[model samples]
Target: MYLHLTGTHLRLLGSMHLFPTTSRRTPPWIAEAYDWADTLVFESDPPTILPLLSANEQGSADRLRPFLPPDAWQHLNAVWPAGGSLAPLAGLRPWAAMIVAPTLFQQVVEGVEPRLLRSALTQGKPYQYLETAEEVAASLDTIPLDAIGAALALLMTDLAEPQRTLERMHAAWLEGDLPAIHRIALESPMFNLPGIREAILDARNRAWAARLTSLLARPERTLVVVGALHLCGPNNLLDCLAHPFEPVPDDAA
Candidate 1:
């Protein structure tokens, strides 16, 4: 969910469902702020639900575009003058290389899937408590029944808003709306699963904190791309920084 961006100009998109974080429209001051930062870092995480493409025999870069946001297409088209003004706003001409960490990829591929899993204890039998991973694993004959059971217990509750927030994040990014992106991050549904939500939040906070620590060590001002969700909660990345920076609100977009 973190990235290292080095260039004269940069645009980073953070997304979470739908909410207006900025004033009501894109503000000129935000663009001016980017000009002052010198190094533009975007902290965001792409949603993991997007499917990965199967590798080709030659492996000539298969496109996972379909699994990406609809706005990416627009942004790609806007790089030119008539389409939009991202180039001027960035101040960096052709743009430098963009670095991204597919954190969501790791989470989705490695995380457990609860609905598809089956319990070994007869379906009709009622078992109230399924606490630990091993207890769930013992009840089934699968790759990792316990893990899936535990993960499902967390992912199944109130996921609609989180997922939508992710989608909205992508949309705002494509449209070059950082403020709107921030709104989505702050207002997305509460991730309050008994055994899962807090764990996920804590894990995310550690990951982002680590990134900030590393960035603080680096001399170059770099732009970081990560998930919008990582920006909120108690220990937010911006909050952890030694220096000061302002969050672009959704209304500004």
Candidate 2:
């Protein structure tokens, strides 16, 4: 995933937000990319630690108890036991819950971006992000509550389904299978929801491409890491960029 530019040093890495548990350490290829780059770019800063929700909080299960029907509430509690690891989700907004749930459910390790971010923090390697917090919030808000509810319901009812899809995506990414990556990303529940593709993936890809366009003008060798999904399907980040990017080839040496 190292993007090559003559007379400039810029690498684009498609990152997995959560790595399979089997991958406990940074892959050598990723380490090489980090070693070569003087600067780094990411989708966003690591989010702030989530605070425990108070009883009066709108998104808390305490408030949701009265709003959802008895059977619905029962199902929620049953699916995510109060003492279970998933219990914290009950305190998050639907959007936040949707994002965190898969990672919580998975047997995973710190992923590509997080691993790099940690190293950057330890070494004091400077970095920046494509979008601000508000822009991310605005994009996430476009996903209807019903869409989030249905997606969550899918996760609850058929736990194996999401796990299978995640496995497929991870495998595709590992193998550098672009078509499979695009297919899996487009077919994922959240992306498949109505109008969500345009709002979440397409818009953000365009915006990120614009930012990278600006960043490429600078002198430093930089590494850019984002979700693997954003680099494929229609209107991918590279395609949206003002100029095309070329990938560095591995030699027989």
Candidate 3:
């Protein structure tokens, strides 16, 4: 989805982190926004958050297994036949595992955030992150162990469904069907867990909105690319923005 500040050279893009390689071409609107902006913004920096994603102790798979249902562990291995990506799980907290599982879908090209970051570096466009690594870690720490176990159980059960869900989400994202993206995403096992929706989505949206309000005072033409959910669903970032902005089909007027 696309949004423009009602009366300034500011733009917002509801970014899908990953897309199927078959559709590897960048969307026109995204390129337009990238070209228009003097600076860009994203959710958080990945490398800075890597440490927080790891557990204090190693052998996370062995440690996590006791808490997970037997069938879920069986299914997790079944889904991860190679154990290439699975190795990362051995040291990750459940919440971190959830974040890492996005590639479980299949045949995804590089995620848009990384691609844009690379471009920003190559072309000399300055950029910034909405949340620091510490902030992201704090948000994730809200997840209790019991909820993690429940989420892992559902994540393993019928992995095929998650694959299909990702495809459906990608399609909706390409079509700019904001409502469809929000509905499909919220249906995930993680979101359904107690208190997770607030911890992961709503609270972050509020925090991002506050950061973005200050950003509005900057003179640079800007493009902010955050997750699609942050721009769509109820209690979304756009709605929380203290400054007025409106969706625009093209460039900001």
Best by TM-score: 3
Which whole-number lDDT from 0 to 100 does residue 90 have in model 2?
Answer: 60
Compose the digit string of candidate 2's lDDT tens values, residues 1-253: 5566544566788877876676566656778778888989999765532332221233443433444455654665565646644465466556666665555466776788878888999999999988877677667656666676666555566556666777788888777777798888766776777656777788899888777777777788888888888878888887897465676555400
Worst 10-residue lDDT window for candidate 3 reads 79-88
Q: Write the per-residue lDDT of candidate 3 for residues 124-180, one digit (tens) a residue.
A: 899988999989878877776677777777767655666677778888988989999
Q: Name the lDDT of candidate 1.
A: 0.34
The global Cα lDDT (0 to 1) of model 2 is 0.69
Give lDDT per model, in order. 0.34, 0.69, 0.76
Q: Which ten residues in a row have the lowest lDDT in candidate 2?
A: 48-57
Q: Taking the tens digit of each residue's C-alpha lDDT, what string does model 1 give over 27-49? A: 24333333333344432212221
Q: Which ranges of candidate 3 are over 4 A from the true structure?
A: 57-67, 77-90, 251-253
Ranked by lDDT from best down, the candidates are 3, 2, 1
State the TM-score for model 1.
0.32
What lDDT score goes with residue 53 in model 2? 20
